[model samples]
Target: MHASVKMQFDAIANDYDRQRKQLIPCFDEFYGMAVSLVECEPSSKVLDLGSGTGLFAGLVMQKYPDIHLTLMDLSDSMLDGARARFSRTDRVQYIVGDYSEYAFSGQYDAVISSLSIHHLTHPDKQRLFHTVYRLLRSGGIFVNADQVQGHTPAADAYYRKQWLEAIHRSGLTQEAIDSSIERRKLDINATLSDQIGWLEAAGFTDVDCMYKYLDFAVFYGKKA
Candidate 1:
C-alpha cells in the first residue's frame, strides 16, 4: 500500500470516531457479539488484526486490564493512530505490515479482526483464516466482525446498493468511495455461511455465526 493511501485513514483518524458515530450501534453489536463468545480475563492474550484507529482494541484493553494485545496493520498511519489511542499502555505491542503475508509471531489466546477482512480477495481471506488457525493454540478461538456477501442474487444487489448509499449518506466523498471500492478490487464478497465453511474446512472446529444484521456478521471458530 502506498504511504498516501494509508494517510487517508490517518487524516480521518481523529474525527473517525465522531464521524462514524452513526455506525456505533452496529459496532456495539459487533463487540457484544464477539465478547459473548470469547470471554476475556487476566490471562487472555489477544491479536487484533487490521486494527484501524484502534477503536475495538481500546475497548478490549480497557475491559481487560491484564490482557496482552498485539495490534497489526499494513498502514503506518493507522498504526500511528492506534499508538496514540492506547498511549501509556505497555500491554500493547504494535506491528506495521500486511498481516496476510507477514509472519504472525506467538500463540494468541484469541484472535479477532474487525471490518477489514472484506477488503481482501476471497483467496486472501482463506489464507488469512488458515494463518489465524495456525497461530491459535489448541482450543483457542478466532472471531471476525466482517461484511458478508449475500447469497441470493436479489439480496446481494440489495445489500450492495444499501451499503453504498449508507456510506454516501454518512459523509464519505464520492471519489473516496469509488477509489476504495476500485483500489482494493473487491469484486465479489462471499456469503457469511461460505466464510464459516472455509473456517471449518481449515480444520477449525465448531465454527458458526455469532451475530448477523443484513450482510454484516461476526463468526467464530475454535482450534481443535
Candidate 2:
C-alpha cells in the first residue's frame, strides 16, 4: 500500500461515514451478495481481511451467530471503530496487519474483503490471492466486493457519470468527486479478467464474477 494513501485513510477515518453515506446502498448490496456466497457451516471459521468498522462482519454475525470471524486491517483507528462496533460479541478477533505481506497461518472456511484492495498495486493484489488461497481450507471461498476498471471507453464514461450522479445526489460536490478521482485513481481499476486469472494462478477453481454494477463488482472463487 502507498504510504500516502494509508495516511489519507487515517485522515479520513473520522469523517468517512459522514462523507460517504452515498456508498451505503451499493455497499449494502455488495455485502449481501458476498455473504450469500459464503459456504459456511454452523462452526465455520471465517476471516475478513481489510475489515473496516465491522459493518459487513456485523451483518455476517447477525446472519450466522455461531460462525467465528477474525477481522484484520492496516489502520489501528479502523480497528478501534470495528472493536467498538462489534463490542457486544466475543466471537470476533481483531488483528492489525497488511494482508499483502502478512502470513496468517491458520486455516479459514471463508475469506472476505469489501471496498478495499483497490489502493494496493496490482502485484500486491495478486499476492493477496495466493495468501487467501493458502489460508483457506479445501473447498473454501474468497469473496471480494470492490471497484473494477471499465472494459471500454464507453463503459468508463458510463461508470464515471453514474458515480458522479450518485455523489451529486448525495450532496457531495463535483470537486469532491474529481478530487477522489485524482487522489484514488479508481476509474483505472484492474480488469476483472486479469484478477480472475490471478486467482486461478493462486490455485482457486470455480472463479466467478458474482455481481456487478458498473465499476462496483463482487467476485469469489473456491480454493481447491
Candidate 3:
C-alpha cells in the first residue's frame, strides 16, 4: 500500500500544487483555518507531518516567516518538490520516511498535517495522534486539514458524489482527474467524531472540528 501511494504521488509531485485548488472545492477556507490555528511564537519550531510537497508548511511559513519547519513525507519525490519550494531558506528540514514509525528527536511548538494522515489505517492514525501529542511542548497545537468519512453510509455516498461532480467540472484534463481518483484509493479516512475522540484519547485538550465542508474538515487540539 505504501509503495503504491509513493509511486502515485511521485508521478504527480510536480503538478500536485497546481491541481490542489481545483480538486479541493473548499481549498481556501480549509487551509486558511488550519494556518490560523497554528498559534505560536514567530521563531517556534514546527513539524509538518506527512508534509507532501510542503504545501501546508509553505502557507504557515508565509504567516510566520521566521518559523523553523521540518517537513516529513513518505515519498522522496514529494519531498524533492518541497526541497525546491524551500530552497531559498536554510530554516527548513526534510525527512523521507513514514511519520507513523519515524523516531523523531526533540519536541515542537506546533505539529500540522494536510491531506496526508487520511492515508493511514485507523489504528495507525490513532497511534500517530499519541505520537504527535508526545512530540509537542505544553500548550502546543495540532492542526489537521484533511478528509474524513461521513457519519453514515448515505452521507458518505453523498459526500463522494458531490466531490466527484465538482472535480469533474473543475476543468482538469481527463488524465489528471483519473490520476487523482487513483490516488484517493489509498485514503482510509476516519469519521470526524472518531478523529476528535482519538485526539482526546491522546491527551489533547479542547479537541474540536473547527471547520467542515462535506468530507473535508480541519481538526484542532492543544496540549495542556
Can you write out model 2's per-residue Cα lDDT over 151-221, one digit (the tens) per residue? 78788788878877777677666765565556565323787788889889999999989998888889989
Query: Residue 128 CA error for candidate 1 (Å)?
Result: 1.3
For model 1, residues 1-224, the per-residue Cα lDDT tens digits are 33444555556566555545444336667777776676655768999998887777777766687888899887767777888888887888899877878976789988888777776778888998999999998889898877788889899778767766776776666665665455434334688878988999888998998898777788989998
TM-score of each: 0.85, 0.89, 0.99
Supply every candidate's count of residue pairs whose N, Cα or C atoms clash at under 3 angstroms. 0, 0, 0
TM-score of candidate 1 against the unseen true structure: 0.85
Q: After superposition, how far is residue 13 of candidate 1 from its true place, in Å?
A: 3.5
Question: Which residues of candidate 2, in runs, are more than 4 Å off?
Answer: 17-21, 172-183, 186-188
Model 2 score (lDDT) = 0.78
Question: Candidate 1 — worst ten consecutive residues by lDDT sum?
Answer: 179-188
Taking the tens digit of each residue's C-alpha lDDT, what string does model 3 give over 97-191? 98989998999999999998998889999999999999999999999999999999999999999999999999999999999988888899899
List candidate 3 stretches off by more than 4 Å.
none
Superposition TM-score, candidate 3 onto the true structure:
0.99
lDDT of each: 0.76, 0.78, 0.94
For candidate 1, the lDDT comes to: 0.76
Strongest candidate by TM-score: 3
